[model samples]
Target: MCGSDLHYYRAENDGTPAESRCIGGHEPAGVVESLGPGVNGARLSVGQRVMVHHYSGCGTCMNCRSGWTQMCTSAPAKVYGKNAHGAHAQYMAVPAACVLPLPDELSFCAGAAIGCGTGTGWGALERLGEVGGLDLVVFGQGPVGLSTTMLATARGARVIAVDPSASRLEQASKFGAADTVNPDSVDPVEAIRELTAGAGAAAAVETSGATVAATAALDALANWGRLCAVGLGGTIAFDVRTFLSRQVTAMTSWSMSSVQQMACADFVARRNLPVDDLFSHHWSLDEAVPAYEEFDKQSAGKAAFVF
Candidate 1:
């Protein structure tokens, strides 16, 4: 399941209303049980196992037509496992446009992560800029942050990963982080600046979703540096003068378009990266109770639930 499920659970866990309940998995994959009417034949067919982009929108809208169906304005967007039933069930009905063909080399779990978790990081970096030979700071060594670290490093960037969790920091190092910082032990901005010989990181990406981390990421940028923000939600307030003076570019990205998702999977396969390194635990649908308890601890990476 995507981490978005945990977010919706926490944000709306308050006495929202009876109608607020919705199916919760977003990153999902399985065979194409059947296709909807007028579904295109280019990317999908019956019995093909595929991962989905999760958002279904009116096909006529500009956003939908432009491959950004998630931002469609035609109607209230229905997200798989959110307002719409997602892939957690034995079968699912997804738009053909939302589907990405999965190669036999990739497992269902890897496909699921590509649909969201890794896709999110990939999209963020795609928009961030060329990272080759650059010093990059990735705040929050969660799943998305780890993906950013791994991908950025694979692109030849020297990665400096920052997080409070020692365990996660260790994982970041294993994932190609050139250096790691425990925010609890030192100011990440200062440490990152020091790591870059006081020029600050050549680029930065903050996936912590914490305002404090976001602010520090902006402050840790080199002159003319770019920062990609993919964390869920947080008010980011930084000194405008400093940002303007440094010519820092900050952009927000969610996940990859269905098209970009295939590119990510290709990168994983071609580069032979260990996408499964993000998984810390696995379970089955029958083991839901304990799975929930383990995930709530937030001390591990993404967990998988086999059907």
Candidate 2:
């Protein structure tokens, strides 16, 4: 499931931290039990292993017709754990269009990540254009950030990871971070510039939900560089003059499209990008409360509640 689930569970409707009695989880992988009448039987068999994309758009929306369902404007978008019931339970009902077939070699846990974490990174990179041979800096070493680092590294780009935790930085290093910057000790912008031989990074993926990290990433971007802000966090002040002078292109990315999710599953299957390492811990469904506590404290990496 995405980190937003943890946020919702820890913070109730008062806009502050409180216990949530609701069942919460979105990243789900299971066998298809049924399909609607309009869906082809051959396209999705009842017993096939599959994962669900958490976001669904109204089929008749202009955005959906244009293959941009994630940004559907005509109708209200349904996001699991937000607008509707999530997948933490044993059974979940999802639109057939949101279902994607999982590869035999991938586990349910890995497939779960593909739908959101990995797919979001893929969408961000796709929006950034060519990244091969470019120097990339990924802020925050969470699932989405680390996935971006791994994907960019796999594409033959040099990646520099920035985070506060040394443990997370170490994990990013294993995923091919050429350099790690802990902002607690050094100025991340200066460090990134030093690593890039004073040219700054060509692209940056900011996944840290902190304003400081976002500002640092933007400040360290090279001329004509693209910055994709994927994290949902506090606002940060930006220097408009610097942005215009440097000609930095900054954009925000949400969850991946259904097609991107499929491509991510295939990429993970082909490259065998260390998905197992992403899960630092696992718990039974009964231990969901403790799981949420641990996640709220940021004491673990990617976690899953096994059935």
**Collision pairs in model 1:** 23-81
lDDT tens digits by residue: candidate 1, 74-143: 7988888778877666667766777888877888888889888888989988898788999999999899
Off by over 4 Å in 2: 13-22, 36-38
* lDDT agreement of model 2 with the native: 0.84
Local accuracy by lDDT, each model: 0.84, 0.84
Q: Residue 30: error of model 1 in Å?
A: 1.7
TM-score of each: 0.94, 0.93
Give stretches of model 1 more than 4 Å off.
Answer: 11-13, 36-43
lDDT of 1 at 11: 54
In candidate 1, where is summed lDDT lowest over 10 consecutive residues? 7-16
